[model samples]
Target: MWELIQSNRRKSLILFFGMGALLILIGYVFGSYYDPEAGGVVGVFFAIVLWVILSALSYFAGSKILLAVSGAKEVTKDVHPQLYNVVEEMKIAAGVPFFPKIYIIDDPAPNAFATGVKPENSAIAVTSGLLSTLNRYELQGVVAHEMSHIVNRDILLMTFAGVMLGVITIMSDIFFRGMYFGGGSRYRSRSSSKSSGQAQVIVMILAIILAILGPVLAQLFYFAISRKREYLADASAARLTRYPEGLANALEKIANSTHKLRSANKVTAPMYIVNPLKREGMKLADLTSTHPPISERIKILRALQQGVSYNDYQRVFEMIHGKKEKIIPDSVLKESIAVTPVIGLTNEDKDFNPIEARREANDAVMKLNDYNFINCKCGVKIKIPPDYNKPIVVCPRCGTRHQLR
Candidate 1:
């Protein structure tokens, strides 16, 4: 695991520097369109400053922003006992130093993601749809997958990459709009000679080309990195849970689902277990996909016939993908960590009903919104919405009065 983290950090640094170089180059290109001599230098400076600020935000406050944008509400173990319990089990199995805070998204899409700068300070969020859809074993698999991302530092890497993509998109948009409104008009007219004017035209053409292609190229980089890490996380999940079928089945359910995540954006798509934007039968994502093909992933998981170790996952992964390169390093294999026994479900997991699951998810969300609950003597529970401004509520079933305040 330490080797994986070290390798991940090394690769992350490369990715950040690579994207940052693109950012600076794009800045310089656009700047030259305005001030051919000095604007390029100014643009380089500006790009550096922008990258620094975004990196800072991404490290410190990015998770909060992502959760807010996704409409995630933090909750206690009481919201869904089995979910908490399963998460707890996986946390122990993975040996995460601290319990990741739990969050619930209100969307009905059955997808989940993890977020933090590191594993020690992290949170995992799932949709209400996931709660209602997945069985206990499947839920554990999804949790383990996200937990793998935390342990692998995939969240941090993806966060930085997403921010880079965002910066590129923003810069490209500004460049296009500037061109559309004749922003570079002063360039040619200010040229002192015909050669200088030609150079300006070339610079303008180059700027336009970059503006058109920057985001596309950046996305290719972003998605390429995203797709690879999903495989790693999937492998890690299998190793942690020692139950490949659980994640395989869970992925099947998620992939076959027709509902696209309502709150998902391009930046957040990579964080989800599956591609959040695409539904079944959409354009098959090639290199630009955030996650690997769900079918391929499920196949690799189910193909782990040898064993449930990292070596086993790598063996099957290569056998399926037909690659000689190793996904699991030789050092990781040497650890020779034996698979731990699987954690059996508790009575709470056994007794879980889909209808009850949905209700529990809804109640958890409402609690976040300040909804009040009261139990009546007649064995009826009263749920009062947050906007219920009245001071008292009468239970419909028991005709009992409950104080709101």
Candidate 2:
């Protein structure tokens, strides 16, 4: 997990420098052609300020904005007791400081994700289909996987990667806009010599090329970073649960599930546990994907279930790609291996008491309600008039019609 964090931080830094350099080059070209006297300084300053302001805004409010855009609604225990219980259990096992807000989308897709700048301020959202489809153990595994993202700070890393990509795209667009709008008119005032005029035209052509290609190059970098983080998050989640079978089974189920999320789009698809966009049949050569291949992920998890270390996993991945494996520090490897799994209820275990779970659930529900209803399975609280001998009861959640006994 630490190695993943370090790798993401390094990538962010490199991209930051790369963007600054690209902006500087574009500014230099623009100044040379249009305002030779002050172009370099103006371009560099503009790039710096733009990068700083944009990055800062994304760092603080990006997660909230993303949740709102995704149409995720905040849920409480009253809304979904089962999901709240699972998330609470996972958060305890992961050693996260505060329990993240839980939410459920109305979509049928079996997908879930975690988002926030930090664990303390985080939230997790899952589809209604995920709840209805997977069994309890499988659901626990999926929730654990998302909690691993929070524990490892994957949300923050991915957010920065997106910001870098966005900045590059903006810079490229600005260059093209300037070219098209005759911002190059300043070039005529820069030089009256024939050679200088020719130089101006050459600079303009180069600027246009850079502008056209910059976004594509930036996107490639963003995708590379995203793919690597997915792998890292998988390994971290495996370590967190210590029972790779649970997550592996969940992944297989998701791949086979027919449900597709209506709210998911290209922007939010990468955030899901599985690609909620349902691109499971796409070929491996489509490397520009926001997610790694599900088959490949399943294979890795199966290997981990057989007690494969992360070092060996990295080696296998590198061999397959024909590239040198990233050498993670021993300390980080040790920490990843140290996460203990939560002890959950099992069919054979005497401790697997449904009654106790129900009691706990009921207690949690009672605490959430201000005025408790005397008779209702849905757990809603409603006041009954004194003259009413037998009042009709309605459950807001399950919608069961009944009368007070």
Candidate 3:
């Protein structure tokens, strides 16, 4: 598993640097096509600047941006202590320095994701639906999956890659728009230098092709990397929780769920534990798909009988497929040991009720939106709508008149 992680890190670094270099090349070609004198150098410099700016944004403000886009609100432990406690437990299991902040989205879609530049800066956000749908142990399984992502350094790599993909998309759009608007004049500029005309035309042609296909290639690579990491995270989650069935059950629920996450988009969808926007007929090994098939994932988790380790998962994967594909590094497999199974949840977890959590999440969202709560003397709590115009209110249960104002 450690070797697998190292391999992932190495591949990620290569992809990041490779994509960055491509962006720089695109910038140079773009600049040279227009100005033959210093345009190429200026373009490279500009690309570097843009890359730096985007990387910084992804590192510093990326989590905040994602939270805001997902309509996630930071939740306090006092509000959702059960969720907080689960996160803390997983944090300890992952051996992170501190507990990642927790956020809740108002959407009823049963999905969750983790994000940040590093473990110390990480955060986990889950939909209100997830809280309402999953029991204590099930929720722990999901949280553990996300914790594994953070501890495994998938967050940083994915976030940076996503940002780089964004840059490529933007640059591609700009190039195409420039071509559509005034490409002929730019091409004619090359005629000013006869000695370099052929070279200039070749560079321009390559630039156009790259700009056209850069985003597509980058996105394909991004999805491929993301899918690989998802498998790794699943194995790590099972290892951390020592209860493979819990996560398997959770995955089943998530996969069968019909609710679509409203806040999910193409860019953010890959960050989720499962693809929030799934298409019909998508297979586990689809190169274009951002996640492995949920059925396949659940199968892998359920097949683990020996213990929750990478070697166990690999063995099951190969057995289930009747193939000898290696998912874990050879070095890690030889050194792998059995992990103790987690028998069950603690007392606090046993006390967690999904129904109550759903009600609590609903009430929290309502309160945040200016709904007023009134505890009546007749053992009934009434929620008053924010826009209610009447001055008086009566408890439906007790017929007691209350002042609305």
lDDT of each: 0.84, 0.68, 0.82
- After superposing candidate 2, which stretches have Cα over 4 Å from the reference? 1-8, 27-34, 281-285, 315-324, 327-331, 334-391, 394-405
Q: Give the TM-score comparing model 3 with the true structure, all chains together.
A: 0.84
**lDDT by residue (tens digit), candidate 1, 1-405:** 788888898889999889988999999988888788788888777777877798899899989998999999888887678789999999998886789999999877899999999777799999988988888888999999999999988988988888888888888888788778975645556678888788888888988898889999999998888888888899899988888888988899888777778899867777899988865333455666777888889999988755788877887888988878667756777775756434443243467587877787777777777887887889887888877798888889878888777
Candidate 3: tens digits of C-alpha lDDT, residues 91-152: 88866676888888888889999988777778999888888878777888999999988877
Which candidate number would show the highest lDDT if scored against the true structure? 1
TM-score of each: 0.86, 0.78, 0.84
> Candidate 2, clashing residue pairs?
none
RMSD to native, candidate 1: 3.7
Q: How far is candidate 2 from the true structure (C-alpha RMSD, Å)?
A: 6.1
**1-405 per-residue lDDT for model 2 (tens digits):** 456667656766776677567766765665555565577577667766777787788788877876777677677776567788888888877676788888666555678888987778889987766766666666778898888778777788777667766766777677667667975646477488998777667877876777777777767776766666677667666665666667777788899887777777877777888877756756654467777888877777666534445654565456554677463434565654433344343332243354554443343333334323454666665544445565576666778876765
**Model 3: number of backbone collisions:** 0
Better of 1 and 3 by lDDT: 1
lDDT for residue 209 in candidate 1, whole number 0-100: 91
Ranking by TM-score: 1, 3, 2
Least accurate 10 contiguous residues by lDDT in model 1? 340-349
lDDT of 1: 0.84
